[model samples]
Target: MKVERQKDEIVVRFSAGKNASKIQSILDYLRYEELTSKSKATQKDLDLLLKETKRGRFDKIIIEMGLDEKDYR
Candidate 1:
């Protein structure tokens, strides 16, 4: 594993091999941290959002907003 800072971005490099899922989990966590750091939401708000996501509320929200997979494709 290797980490470096380039300008305003932090870069991480690693060999996935048999640990691809673990690496992806770490990356997902880091991405969440980065997003929350720049947002006004509190930890409680984030926790609630995560809980709702786990319950698939976001899928319903997408439908409410008239978004569909076909829109992306």
Candidate 2:
């Protein structure tokens, strides 16, 4: 996992490693939450996120948010 800051947005990168399913689930949950507030997430919103995750771009979000790996255990 790795993190980087880019202007107003933070960048996250993760390899998915051995916990790809878990990671994807968590991402789905987050997306759900974000969409919940707006009632729904458009296809474009999901597509962009999926594209980034496919490229391993979530480490920064984890790092910036300071998620503990053990916490997921």
By lDDT, the best candidate is 1
lDDT of 1 at 7: 100
In the range 1-73, model 2's lDDT, one tens digit per residue, is 8889999876679985898898889889988786788656698998998988854645655667889845543
Quote the positional error of residue 49 for candidate 2 in Å.
26
Q: Residue 4's C-alpha lDDT in candidate 2?
A: 96
Compared with the true structure, the alpha-carbon lDDT of candidate 2 equals 0.77
TM-score for candidate 1: 0.51
| Model 2 regions more than 4 Å off | 40-73
> What TM-score does each of the candidates earn?
0.51, 0.43
- Model 1 misplacement above 4 A: 42-73
lDDT of 1 by residue, 1-73 (tens): 8999999988889975999998889889988897878788788997998997865866666778899846643
Model 1 steric clash pairs: none
Query: Model 1 misses residue 47 by how many Å?
Result: 8.1
